[model samples]
Target: MPSPLPADLTPTELVELMQRLTLEEQAELDHLLTAGLPRWLPQVGPQTDALESEADIVFYGGQAGGGKSDLLLGAALTRHEHSIIFRRESVQLVGLEERVARILGSRSGYNGQAKVWRLPGATPRILEFGSVKEPNDWMKYQGRAHDLKGFDEITHFLETQFRTLIGWMRTDNPSVRQRVICAGNPPTDAEGEWVIRYWAPWLDPQHPNPAQPGELRWFVTDEEGGDREVPGPEPVMVGGELMTPKSRTFIRSSVDDNLFLQLTGYKATLQALPEPLRSQMLRGNFMAGRSDPVWQLIPTDWVKAAMTRWSPRQEKGPMTALGLDPSRGGADKTSAARRHGAWFDVLVTAPGQVTCDGPTAAGFVAPLVRNGACICVDSIGIGSSALDFIKGLNLLVLAVAGSEASTGSTVAGNLRFRNKRAEMYWRLREALDPAAEPPIALPPDQELLGDLCAVRYKVAQLGKAAAIQIRDKDEIRELLGRSPDKGDSVALTFVSGIPMPGPARQRTAREVPDWRVC
Candidate 1:
């Protein structure tokens, strides 16, 4: 009698056993097992490229109707041993779930309550669908591990939530592969702009070093938690420790890439949309929706022009001023900007975990403050603590309180501001104006650019006249999804005229003046 087949034979074990069988027997057994298996494979173009990409992180979609959702689902089903795909909300999973049911020919392996599909085999594969709706909702999956993680419509989620959930991507199974795949269209709003910065080498027109589509680049986090791109994929020494950089790439796909979508008349639908939306959806233009808001305090084009004029080799005057925006313990960061005449240096930031207290914040500022540089510090809330420490050291410091009354007007002298913050920000705006003498040169920094462009202004009635009032910090935070630390620091640079520090003078608590435009 023939030996009985093993009940717990894994796919790998079965493949090994098949090698010992006769050619006819092997063919017969292969036909018996796979004859009626439901088929789902990646489509021919960008979808296949995405599936074959060996990048640690891959961003796959640019335009709508590109079969992005199906790409995520098919990758999980066909290749991964354990996978989870996320949408911003649970309701978005309905269509995906239905498609999954059709592919399997039945819902027998699906556990709707747990939102997982357990494929039957000796080593069962697991596919899960989840949502992270709120900012803190990512904590729900804190410790759960998966070999492959997918984010659909990634721009709809906060960057923090995306980073936190991807921290759990891991696998112990030797047969499984590890990767993160994100699919989304270009961001439609200011809040989603982080995605552009995250993939700047591919998306940002002003990126110093641009990369072609599907080109691989490597990046590692610096000591301050900011990403720094390296030369190649090799491990490098950082902060005295060896670290390996993660490889990332972007693959652009549009409606044209999906023949099925093209035949369904999706191209015309995208073209019928409004101005910016139509351009964004049809051409996959990352630069769409970049027009400044009507009340935007600063124009986007002005900032871009300033960045273009800036070069590391440009001659700069002595460091004249320093601006500090300190943060209390939490997700916030303590940021500083140093100004030399019309040129500003790249921002320096320390996470709240490192610079939470007064002394710690002071420590970060002290070494950066030169002998003649006038230091401007935000004196509201936790910033006041840092200001106190700096003042104690006998440094020339200007304590900035945004809520205080404005002591200055626009450079043209015709416009008035509601408060010091408005006045300070307006000064930077005036300096950046194309017609202004001594044009400002700003370092190419994406977060600083976003912060400067995100704020809006309105005319507020002040007794007999109208004054320009900027929106509250809390409101801007809601729109940008984080505090405008970099913007605040840059604005603070203009709190007072660049003073020529004559001599070291003994100072009292009251000697530290409130923000006053010299």
Candidate 2:
């Protein structure tokens, strides 16, 4: 329950008082009263709900750069006397200490000798910062009482360490509240795996759980202590009275949810990571059934290097072409990219308009089409309408059907490419490969690079023949936060080996765009 209003003040008076307060004063009041401090990002605001709720266990985590650390720091910055923070080492706490100092007006009231903060107007608040480096370290707080305790990364310590701390979290003063805060990224080790198990109902899909990203859930139990999802059937008959259940919740976060981190290009670094690690760190693909060792279509490093390849910034092909992957609503992204031939380097990549109706998308790209640029449109899902819309513009167009792309079976230099989409993806790799004469360039987009790198392929047997099957958009969307629309938009550029959109200029040059039919 939220904090009650002051006994002497009515709702109207409280509203009037709130109206008179400035934004900074309101923020500080919110922080001091309800643990509602905010970080540089808004998604983390839900975490404050998790912190303030009356829960037996609360965990916040999932992906990196979610401002979890700063949250823990802010939660610990209260005037309580018995608040403590735990990390793997004391040096690890220094950064948080500096952050708290800046947040608390740069006042260094912490007395290192006593392990307490000596704010002038308040009682001497004991803030213990301890290290749980080994199993024996859990005993350090055996005799102490902590009203508030926070774990920087719970998985870094043994399960025993966490359980021991639970006992120490108690308060004798009626007005003082007891709370626990823990923050971490996805666990990468056995200890982390243990945490997932300990909180299986909250983290695992095997159980029927009712927790949302920030919502708290209450649970009761019988004598055996097994968690009860719903209570009040018999109320556990605790001492002939209705017993209340404790609450617990988990709040998930990712780099995308943190706007500040996104601005710093942290996502590109996560995307550049290698396979299973990349899936775990970037996509938060925890305990999933499988992650193919690779995209099977292209390597991540190759695309990353393509993003870094030195190329003239202002080069324009004799003719330009547009790649459009249309989406309607909800989770889909209407990605569109423009590239110049014959090198076929991407120049710009962006999302199309709202609703992404065929006509709307057609209108967005009509000017480019009128500039004599051919367009390769994904004629799948909402894209079919988009294709017709663009075609209705009386503009040059190449349609990439999800069904299949090639007229004859063999394509792209005698390779039995599965379908048009596969053929285009493979040819895109060929175009970007450094070994290929006249290496191509691509837009320096992190998401575009990540999606391109994530494409995978597999060979299938059809009795007497072998064929390649590319990973589909739905499968790709599961790993990527959204559909790989941008990547596919670029892939569409290779739909057909049409001549570079200008008068013939390079039949004799090795570095010129290849004018061959795939």
Candidate 3:
């Protein structure tokens, strides 16, 4: 026989009874409060009672130990009869499911029946927990749509993987709006370009001050080349105005904002970190590892002063070859230089350099040609544009391919990109040294240092596990944001044919003499 119902109770009566649960339940609530709501907790709380707009997307961010999981579960519990919490870590997901089962499992409805719960709910079950750490597991999300979706530690999963899972959130109920809530800490790498570009606009530099949530939307370009806004709630608003059609909302939370993190544990955890991870995880700096262990090849001070000297100077002597590196639209950078057996910064043009969309290769090329500098640029993809401007000027454009070698090789140049870049970086590092007088002084350009800093290495595969690799394109693009046309041009110039000075060509009749004059 079923137990008797608590009573025919009013909302106030229900609240009182709910509050008067057994000591075990009270202890669990206290544990939840301590973990989820402490003042030192790293995420925002239920300060706003209003239901969020049915925006197509939403995001939550902050340091770890913030009641992010609890908030996500609580939000879903509001209107979602069925939900799925997608956890990247199996351990975390299992722990959460166990907690939910224990907390909401025993409570009886007014009818004195056990609260209903199911993993794969019937007729499209309402609640399920899934993991996405392994690539194949994402298969579970297919053909199964839910009204609510929650992702914990979103950054750990690949962007493509996350997108695939979110496709399952569609539901048939008009009144039941679908929601996709994601929470994570800062990304672990600068190469995670998508994260910074998508989230930077809405995140506060400092957290715990309560930020309005933000959303980033995309549109399909119409046949006429005009952009049409995709369907969704008015772009999520912040500061009383709807975000731009392409804007994204990023909610920044911190330990203090959580109002639940224990002060002693938070401080203890922070102190225990080995410094770099602590800065990134606790302090929330995406670029924290900029000059750390991987980049320890060069000291920070060497490049700090080198950044102040790179600028255009009046042409001196015959311009040698110009090296070029073409980019794929504004997504890459193009670099150029006239090397006298040494690299020099001629132009650093890209999207990030100035707020524009296309290549400025011509602008850079025109000046070098007028100065009689022969240019060499990588014309792979969209870089073919460089050819149009290269005509009539003494220039050579080459298509350079990234290293095809695999990871784990020794003798440096075995991996294409890092081999060439390692040499270039070494030279630049040497030139930047304040201690050693450089054979040639480069004009200071922090942008170059920024690009150099952005470059990262990867283990290249070379049939055997003996080759290593690192590509500079990503880092180079961050500094220039378009493509390193000028950077590539410089490298090419250093390796290409020399430029003979104008009106100073030698006659065939003149015999060459050796350095030894007898």
Query: For every model shown, what is its TM-score relative to the native structure?
Result: 0.81, 0.44, 0.52
* lDDT value, residue 35 of candidate 3: 72
- The candidate maximizing lDDT is 1
Order of candidate numbers by TM-score, starting with the best:
1, 3, 2
* Model number with the top TM-score: 1
As for model 1, its CA RMSD to the true structure in angstroms is 9.7
Ranking by lDDT: 1, 2, 3
Model 1 residue 340 lDDT score: 87
Q: Is candidate 1 or candidate 2 better by TM-score?
A: 1
Look at candidate 1 and tell me the lDDT of residue 290: 51
User: How much is 440 displaced in model 1, in angstroms?
Assistant: 2.0
lDDT of each: 0.83, 0.63, 0.49
Q: 357-469, model 2: which lDDT tens digit per residue?
A: 76766665554442467787887777778778666656677777856745433334445566777778877877777786666667565457557866788876534656566
Q: To one decimal, what is the Cα RMSD in angstroms of model 3 from the true structure?
A: 12.6
